[model samples]
Target: MKKVKRRAMSVLAIILCLMIGVSVFTYRFFSQGSQWVNFTANKHIYSNGVLIGGAIYDRDGNPLVHTVDGVRKYSDNESVRCATMHIVGDKKSNIATSLQKVYADELMGYNTINGTYSVSGTGNSVYTTLDADICAAAYEQLKGKKGTICIYNYKTGEVICLVSTPTYDPENPPVISADDDNYDGVYINRALSSRFTPGSVYKLVTAAAAIDNIDDIFEQTFTCHKTEVINGQKIICSGTHYEENFEKSLNNSCNIAFGNISRQLGWNTTAEYAQKLGITTAHELSGIPVVKGSIATSGGDNELSWTGIGQNTDLVNPFAMMRVVGIIANHGMCVEPYLVEKVTNSSGFRTQLPPNKTEKRYLSQSTADTLSDMMRSNVRNKYGESNYPAGMEFCAKTGTAELDGSQVSHSWFVGFSRNEKYPYAFVSFVQNGGSGAKVAGVAVTRVMTAVKEKVDSQSTAN
Candidate 1:
């Protein structure tokens, strides 16, 4: 009887151990499933070097990407293929299209029940907020330049146009292994991943800092000699901007005026506002790798002044710039950007993928109003005047950040439109692109026009 009791106890212990082992294995599988799915070679969904996913479509129900004859294919149009290539991604597995790899399971329509052993039928479909035509238009504005252009609705945070230039056709992807002549950073999504120097456009940060910290920020005026000496360090302006007020100084892109403002406000004050505006902060956008923006605040008066005017070690992501502008258009509310609008499984069940908000206040309504007034005047009086349509209203800022040991600067243009029919905020950045107002701003103008036209046509049809 004693021997029988010992046998029962041994069986119970063995069962308990098996249960614990299964629990641990289940935990690891559920938590790090994407990592395991990264190895696409053994996946049954992909055959003959083609992704057998359901499909990826634009917001307008236009098919940007789909599988045909068991092979992944893009739209027949070359421009469309190039425009949405980085966003929808290519079949080639490389470092640039990590977003594609991350969503490989979903693309294969991997299901917990039916897909436990194999992903049967076509994968789930991913429908994004991107407009393929608008994406192509934005890409054309890049004009073979290395840049990123992104636009989203301020009201809903729906990203309409996200294009990265120097892109390649998804159908004929370049070889990554050998010394392929066609490989030209085609897979890199510069809009979300690249970090570039944001020059004068960074003045928006300094201006916001001043507006928030300084009691009489608007009343203060500044004088410049094309260079100002502070703490034995010289701060240089592009040209002499003499006795300029806050509004005129910004419109003129006066370096001396902003340098002085930085000295007065100091690094602490500037950093405070910069954080609020998403500078130097990392944002976790779903399924996309977004680089963080940073400010150099450890230097003396000279460095502080230079940093104030959007120079002296200032690095910003184009996406961050877009969200900052979105905050202004969103009336001081934080706007988290999102791409995929919905995902439909093979069973015909659909799940909406709207942006998740942090409920964090980026700017006060009064401050946004004040800044909007300055930016509104900026569009009318500055470089933006001639580029936009006549009688159309918008607010924008241009940044011409000088690169390290380079003659040309990283040009940046950020803005939001005031049209009730088309409320969009956009950011355009061109690497080594001369003049923020000229090179980058031109692209912004074209993209905004395309979006406006799209809205008008849709409204007319409705």
Candidate 2:
């Protein structure tokens, strides 16, 4: 009797173990089934790691990439292929955030139930919110310089133009060596992966902080003598602006006055406002991660002053800065930027991605209005309206970030259009490019002019 009872207990234990193992397998199969099916090792949708099917098109239905008889092909125009190489991706998966790599499962038509088998002779189609012509225009403005230019519709969160330079032709990729100066950072997308010293463009954040924290900030007066001593450190300015109010200080890009303002705001307040302004926040666009900007709050009074002026240990991502300007343009609220516009499955079922509806209010309406007026004054009085297209109503700020070891300062131009018809925000950054108003600012004007022309033409056609 004892032997028989032990046998029954052993049988029960074995049954329980098998049941638990099956449950765990079932759970993973339901949760991560798509990842397994979309793996590059799969032979159905991918041919030696390259997607065998599916097509990628721009907003205007311009084909950017398509699979031709089991072979991948890019745009016929070499310039367009190079301009959008970073976004469309290459065969070897060098660009991680490219549509080919990030949205592979969608392109392969892998659903939870049907898997890759649901895919017909061809894979699904991906339609992006990018404008091929605008991207090509931006690429031309880069002029072989290493930099990035991104422009997006602030109201709809549609990224119209995103161009990163040092890109090669996707149809014929070059062998990039580590010591190749021209090909440095060729694999990385500068707009999404890199951070820059924001320069005086960061003053926008300091200005926003002042408007909210300082009660009588607009009424205050400051003096600039081309240089001022704060916390025993010398803060230099481009020119001497004898005496000026808060608005004039910004218009002149007075470092001494801003350094003094920073001293008053202190490190704690400055860091708090930087976080609130989305400078220190990481955002994801259409499943691609954007690196966040950084600021250091733990420092002496001198460091605090420099930080306030966007100098000390301050690094900003161009995309983040563009979003900040977009938020300001949208009156303190903004839709998160996205690239993928829609997807059409092989079964003829189309899915249109809705704009991000999460109402993120980073600033109060009053502060945004005040800043808008100040930025407009910046374009009209400081940056010169002639620098932009006529009647653009362009509001802008330019920054020249000084680097160490005699490297030329990085040029930065960030701003938004107040024109209701073309509600867009843009960021232009040029590495080792001197004069933000000249180099980076010119890039912005050229690209925005192209954008304005397109908008007007579309309106006429409609």
Candidate 3:
């Protein structure tokens, strides 16, 4: 009787272990089943690790890339193909952030129940919110320059134009040598993947912080003798502006005045405002993660002053900066940017993505309005409105980020359109480009013109 009882106990333990094992397996299958099915090694969706099926289309139904009889094909227009290579991806899956790699499971029509079993031989279709023509125009403007251009709707959160430089045509890829300086970081998308020194464009954050914290910020006045000393360190100005008020100081990009303001705000408050403005945040656009900008507050008064003027250890992502401008344009609230608009499966079923326009307020409406007026003054009084398309209502700030060891400063132009019909925010970065207003401003003008034309044409057609 004792032996039988011991045998029953052993059987019960074994049964309990098996049940627990099955439950864990079931949970993992449900949680991570898509990853398993979409693995590059899967024979159904991949051919030697290259995605075998699916089509990618732009907003205008222009085919950016599609698979024909198990072979991938790109757009016929060479310029368009090269311009969108970073977004559509290459054959080897080198661009990790490409929609092709990020949305592979959906492109392959993978579902927990069907698992590509019901997918047609041609696979699925991913319709993006990108405008191919605008991308092409921006790419042309970026020729021979290593940088990026991004423009998205502040109201709708649709990324209409996103073009990264140093991209090669997928059909005729170049042999990039590691020692070549021109092809450095060719695979990386600067708009979404890289960070740059914010330069004077960071003044917007400083201004926002001061607007909310300092009651007499606008009424403050300072004199620029081309330099100012803070904590035994010299803050140099580009030019002597004599005596100036707060708005005039911003218009002149007076470093001396900003350095003084920085000393007043202190490192802690500056870092706090940077975080609140989304400079230190990592945002995802349809599963494609944007690299976060960074700031360091552990520094002396001199370093703090530099940080306030977008120097020191401050670095910003172009996408995030563009989104910041969008927040200002949308009156304190931002419509989170997104790329993938919808997906259609092989079985003729279409799934439209929900709008990511959350009503999260990043700034007070009053602050945004004040910033908008100031940015408009920047374009009208400083950058020259005649440089942009007529009636663009362009509000912008240009930054020339000084680099280490005599490298030309990076050129940055970040702004938005106040026109109700074209509520777009844009960022243009030119690596090693001198003078943001002259170098990056030219690119912004050309690209925004193209964007305006596209918008006008669409309105007419509708």
Candidate 4:
């Protein structure tokens, strides 16, 4: 009898394990699969005047989209429509970047208990964390450009502004078919999907590795020439820098200095730090799809040197680039970027979304502080302090990322600004643009100025 009881208990445990495995697989399939095309896969349910979903709103409760008279309606503001197309997505579900499709279950107010979503929906609304005004401002600043600009509060992990180009008004979204590249369809979300060469911006990774492994990294000095020859390969920089310390090397954006430093660090430590700083990973921003950053983990001495200076198969997603900068701003600990703030169902049950928390500590607080100081010096010595809003203490790094000889290089600026009132990290990318300082960095001045004014006004009003 005791043996029989033992056998029964073992069978029960096996069944329980199977059930748990099935549950886990189901959850993963839904959440992960929901990211792309699954949300709108059942469009027929919303057809024939059946209310298939709920509304979407900005954090301020400003409505973005809702069903009216059995038809999905978007705001009439063309700028808002164009600026936020990738975030909200159109009703037709043609674009790959449609957030509505990703969150269709919540939008439809699908009830697990009842297993039904009413035609009128449960009035469950998905509140996004986006600020529409900031999106519009970013879009306007990026007019006629092929890049993206993003600003998020690193401490709160609230993405403030996210603007991508090649956008079209949702009200009059054009047809998308084979022969047309998003040049006319306006489907690409450059901020999240596109990857670019980081240029000198990646020096932050090489520098961070050096700091962690090398002794008193700041004390080390390096010499730079117009063209540096290493292993029969010529690495070029903006100009010759006679002798430069860690801070000066960053401020001067010296390629040779950074290349030698990269060689010293080698591919192993550099690759380790890059992964820690999120340079080779796809960031998960729930409902948003960001391409993973790319790098060469192993290479020859000359190849590793160029990789250190932000070249040689090193392609970084713009969002990940901004996030690495944000990690620095947050002193190595950061919150995950969240879009949906809350979800309210038709049953009047409101679920408040928790702040997306980051589980890993990417760097030590001391490392972040040292890198932050170096960035500030870069701003003061290279990018003029006057260029930014007056009295704003900020840090910056400029990247003139090169491409093929046929096209101009990309202009990239990555940095953060913090004060008693505001804590923001930003990245601006301009394709085929001029110098990073003159173009992308200059663009930051007006944007940050506007941000400061708005913050001040809001404070006074409060």
Q: Cα RMSDs of all predictions?
A: 2.9, 1.8, 2.0, 6.2
Per-residue accuracy of model 3 over 1-462 as CA lDDT, tens digit each: 999999999999999999999999999888999889878888877887888888999999999999876678899898899889999998879998998888887787777777776445777899999999989999999888999999999988999889999898998888888899888898899999999998999999998988888889888888889977777778888899988988888899889888888888988899898899889999888789999999878788888888989988899999999999999999999888889888987766784455555657999999998999999999889878888888779999999998899799999999988997888999999999989998888898898998888879888999
lDDT of 4 by residue, 1-462 (tens): 999999999999999999999999788766664333233344544653233467888777777787776677776567777777788886566556666766666776554443344545444688777888777777787777777888888887788778787677778866667676445435767778788888988988888888888886778988887788888889888898988888899899899888888888988888888888887887767766788888888968889998999988899988888888888888888766666777877565674465456545788989888999999888778788877776668888999998878889899998988563768888999877868888888776677777888888898999
Q: Backbone clashes per model, in order?
A: 5, 0, 0, 2
Candidate 3's error at 349, in angstroms? Answer: 2.2
Query: Global lDDT of each model?
Result: 0.79, 0.88, 0.88, 0.78
* TM value for model 3: 0.94
lDDT of 1 at 413: 88
Q: Rank the candidates by TM-score, best first.
A: 2, 3, 1, 4
1-462 in candidate 1: lDDT tens per residue? Answer: 999999999999999999999999898877765555445555665555445666888988788877777767778778888888887777665545444565666666664444423234666778788888898898889857888899988877788988888777777765465555344565678888778778888898888888888888789888988887888878888988788889999888899999888989988888888887987787766667688888986788889988888888888888998998888877788757878777877665673354464444688998887787888889888765767854447789988888777468888889888664677889998888888888898888987887788777888999
* Best model number under lDDT: 3
Clashing residue pairs found in predicted model 1: 199-401, 200-399, 200-400, 201-399, 280-293
Pick by TM-score: which candidate is best? 2
Error of 2 at 116 (Å): 1.1
Task: Return the clash pairs for model 4, or none.
Answer: 51-119, 122-346
- State TM-scores per candidate: 0.91, 0.95, 0.94, 0.87
Consecutive 10-residue window with the lowest summed lDDT within model 4: 33-42
CA lDDT for candidate 2: 0.88
Error of 4 at 268 (Å): 0.3
Task: Name the candidate, 1 or 4, with the larger TM-score value.
Answer: 1
213 Cα displacement, candidate 4 (Å): 1.5
